[model samples]
Every structure is written in structure tokens, then in C-alpha cells.
Target chain A: MGRVVVEVMPKPEILDPQGKAVVGALPRLGFTQFVGVRQGKRFELEVEGDVTPEILAAARQAAETMLSNPIIEDVVNVFEAEVSA
Target chain B: MGRVVVEVMPKPEILDPQGKAVVGALPRLGFTQFVGVRQGKRFELEVEGDVTPEILAAARQAAETMLSNPIIEDVVNVFEAEVSA
Candidate 1:
């Protein structure tokens, strides 16, 4: 099956509490190299056939409309993903 | 500054309610080309300098131990990301 990958991230100006929690937890876990952390969402949409341009456009529209809140998040990426199986 | 991208996804055998909900909602929204959906996580780790091998290793470690729950989730990808700014 063909798959499409869509990535969504909080806007740069938005405050991400989950990411802040992760940043706070990292130092305690002895991984202090990271200066910041931002948590986001990844989606995989499965298709029965090849990922056509129409499917990609539909996925992008779904990403912007259903998957993410445009005011708080940005659709950072939308692309066809190689399916291993 | 440099960034490292980490992706985590639920195990295939695991049930993903959010993904299922998306799949169910897709057809109602008039985009019915998709067969399935899986929701996961994306994390961006910021570093003060370049993403070195050591940082990559640390990110991998963090991904496995902290970012994802080994019981139901898998760390899918960990790589350096080019920073535009």
C-alpha cells in the first residue's frame, strides 16, 4: 500500500507545555545536550494504490483542515512515504 | 544551531483510536481515497552547535527510552535536520 506522511508542528510563537515537560525531563535523564524540545504530530495515511498527485493534494487538504489546527499548528510537511510492506 | 528530528509510531499490532477516528472521518469529509491512518509523534531537538555523532547517539537513546514507550510504540527515525536559521 502507498502511504503519505504528514507532519504538524506548533507555531513558533506558541507555547508547548508538552515540549517544555520533555525539556525538563531530559536533563534529569542525563541527556543534557539538547537545548530545546518541540513535540509535534506525525500521520501516516494508507492508500490502496500509488500515491498520485491528487491523493497528495487531498492529504495536504486533510492535514490543513482536519489533522491540524491552523491557528496553533503548521503543516510542516506532506509527502509520499515508502512502504516497506 | 542544529536540529535533530525523531519520529515514533505505534506498533502495527496496536490499536490506534486517533488514527481510526481519522479514517472514519475522512469519508464524511468527502475524501475517501485513504484506507487507513496512523497517528504518531515527531520531535525536534535543538542544539547549540552542529548535530554531531555523539548528539545523534544521544538522540537515539532518548528516542528509545524517553520519547517512546517500548511497550506499544517504536522509534522509527532519528536524523539530523538542516536548520534554515
Candidate 2:
């Protein structure tokens, strides 16, 4: 098997309300040095077969088509590895 | 400066509706092998000062207090590294 990791985030120019909210709350939580915070999503998957270029391509396509919002978000990164037996 | 990486995810027992929606959309996007997909958050921060244990601790605390929802989510991982000058 193989494992896939995908990270999704809002486009840098877009305002991240979720991130802003977290940043705003940091001071109350005793985090005085924290100046900013941005929130995004990570996805990990265990695929049921050998890792191949075709599989990776399909996975990337899947991410773009269904897993992420192309207009408001960006696909930050995608990584894959073999699952240990 | 330092860099902080935080990954947040739903508790394993909690049903991830966003993940489910992604899984449902995969098939339509021509990804037949994808049986499941879970989504979470990743935060990468460039701190403005040297890397220290105290900074790392504060960052973790901030993640717990404001960056994550403790009830329905779990802090999957937190990592820190010194930034190259």
C-alpha cells in the first residue's frame, strides 16, 4: 500500500477568517509573541496498491477536481510514500 | 527565527463530514481507487525570533487554545525548527 498526504490552504491573497480568529485568540491564551496564524487542511490517505506515477497523477487530479476549491484555495503540497508492511 | 508546523485533525471516533464529501466526490472525478479521504489542518509559521523551548511550548499552547477545537478535533502533531538566517 501507499500513503498520500495533501495540504490545502486559502490563497495567500485571500483573507483567512478562521486563521484571523485564531490569531486574535492567541493573546488571551498566553501566547503574546504570536503575531499571525493561518489555518489550512491536511489529508492523509492509504491507497490499496503499489505507488506509481499514474496513481500519483490520478491522486493529484482528484485533489484539484474534488478535494480543493481552486478559486478560493490552493493545493499547497502533495506527498506520497510506501506503507510499511 | 523559527518555524512551527501544526497538524490538526478530527478525533478518530468523530465522523468527518468534509472527508466524507471528498470521498464521495472522488469517484465522479475518475478516482475509483480512493475509498476514503479525511481532511484536516496544517499551520506553518515563521516566528520572529530564535527557536527556544519556551517558544515551542507557547506555540503548542496557542494551537490547543485557539487554533484547534479540542472537543471534536485532536492535535495530530507539532514540530518546530530553526529558520536559516
Candidate 3:
């Protein structure tokens, strides 16, 4: 089966409390190299056959409409999952 | 500034209700081309300078310890966020 990967992230203007919490915790955990953190969502959409252009198009549409909230998030990426991830 | 991207996904053996919910909703949204779905997390860790090897290593460590639940989730990828994503 082929898989499509979609990534969605909070918009720059939006406040991400989860990310803030992570950044706050990281320093205490000794991961001080990181100055900031932003959390997002990743999805793998599996198909029965090859991931055709049509399938990618549909996945992009789904990523935009259903996977992410346009008001607060942006669909940052929509691509074929070539790697095992 | 530079960013490191960390991806975490549920282990194959683990049940992903969130993914099942998405797969179930796809058909209703006219996205029937997809057969299955898996939901995961994406984290962007921002640093003040270039994403050095040390920063990546720290991100990897954080991904394993703080970003994902080792019991049920896997840290699938840890890399520099080369693209705008």
C-alpha cells in the first residue's frame, strides 16, 4: 500500500499552549539547546494502490479541509510517504 | 534561527482510535481513495543559530524522552527542518 503524509501546524499568529508547555519543560529536562517549540500534527493516509497524482490532490484537499483548521492552522505539507515514516 | 523536526507515531501494535476516526470520516467527506489513516505528532524545535549536530542530538534525546511515550509511540524521524515546514 502507498501512503501519503500530511502535516499541519499552528499559524504563526496563533498561540500554541502545548508548545509553550513543552518549551517550558524542556529546559528543566536539560534540553536547553532548544529555545522554542511548536507542536503540530502529522497524518499518514494509506491507499490500496499507488499514490497517484489524483490521490495526492484528494489528500491535499482533505488536509486543508478536515485535517487542519484554516483559522488557526496551516497544512504545511502534503507528500508521498517515501520513507518508512 | 534553525529548526529541528521530530515526528512521533503510534507503534504498529498499538491501537490508534484517532486514526480509525479519520479513516471512518474520509469516505463521508468524499475522500474515499484513502483506505486507512494514522495520526501522529510533529514538533518543531527552534534554536538561535544553525541546527548543529549537537542540537539534533538533543532534539533526538528530547523526542525519545519528552516528546513521545516510549511504551506506545515511536520517534520515527528527527531531522533539521530544511523546508519551510
Candidate 4:
């Protein structure tokens, strides 16, 4: 199976409460080396055949339309993943 | 500033309902070249300094202990990302 990985994140201008909570808790966990944190979603998709530009384009569309809310989120990256059985 | 991206995914043995729902809806949306899909979480952390192995290790621990439930989820990969301002 071919694969593609799409990342959906809150747009840079948006506030991420979950991310802030995690960042706040990090210091309590004795981790103070971090300056900030943002959490997002990843979709690892198994395509029907070899991953090509066409497949990636379709995947990007799927991500934009199905996986993310374009108003509040951004599709950060699309990666051709190594698919193994 | 340095950065580390940690991806957390449900274990292979686990079931992913959200991914299934998206995959199920794909064909209805007129795109059906996919076999399966798995959804996961991505953490983008901005560290105080450059991302080194030590920083990666700390991030891994943060992911394993704080970000993910190791019993049901797995931390897949850790990448060093370019921190642009």
C-alpha cells in the first residue's frame, strides 16, 4: 500500500487551548526547557496503489475537505510515506 | 529556538473510529482509492534552544508520559524541525 501523511493544525493566528494546557503542565512536570507547544492531527492514509502526484493531490483534497476545517485549521504538510506490509 | 515534532498514533492492534468514519465518507465524496486510514496526534514543541539528541530524548519522554498513553497509543517518530523565528 502506498501512503500519505497529512498534518492539520490550528492556523497560526488561532489560539490553541489544548496546546496551552500542555505547555502549562510541562513546567509542573519539571520540564522547563520548552518555550511553546502546539498540538495537531495527523492522518496516515493507505492509498490503493503507488503514491504519485495525482494520489497526493487527491489526498490533499481529502484532507482539506474531510479532515480539517479550513476556517480554523491549516493543512501543514503532505508527506509521501514509506508503506510496508 | 529549536523544535521537535512528535507523532502519536493508536497502536496497530487498536481500532480507530474517526479514521474509519473519514475513510467511509471518502467514497461518498467521490474519491475512493484508499484502503485504510489511521488518525493520530502531532505535537510541535518550540524548545528554548537547538534541537539536539538530548532535547529529542526529553521530548520523547514528554510525549510518552504526558502526551500519549503508551498502553493504547504509540509514539511513532520524532523529527527535528527548523525553527523560524
lDDT of 1 by residue, B5-46 (tens): 999999999999999999999999998999999999999999
TM-score of candidate 4 against the unseen true structure: 0.94
RMSD of 1: 0.6
lDDT of 4: 0.89
Q: What 10-residue stretch in candidate 2 chain B is worst by lDDT?
A: B76-85
Better of 1 and 2 by DockQ: 1
lDDT (tens digit, per residue) of candidate 2 on A1-85:
6778788878888899988887777777667776666677898765777657777778787768777799998887788844443
The residue-by-residue lDDT of candidate 1 on A1-85, one tens digit each, is: 8999999999889999999999999999999999999999999999998999999999999999999999999999999999985
DockQ of 4: 0.84
Per-residue C-alpha lDDT of model 4 across residues A1-85, encoded as one tens digit per residue: 7899999989888999989999999989977878899999999989876998988998999989988999999999888998654
Give the range of the ten consecutive residues with the poorest summed lDDT in model 4 chain B. B76-85
Candidate 1 clash pair list: none
lDDT of 4 by residue, B1-85 (tens): 8889989988889999988988898899987877799999998999876888888888989998999999989998888987654
TM-scores, one per candidate: 0.99, 0.85, 0.97, 0.94
Give the poorly placed runs of model 2, Cα more than 4 Å off: A81-85, B81-85
Off by over 4 Å in 1: none
What fraction of native interface contacts is shared by candidate 1? Answer: 0.84
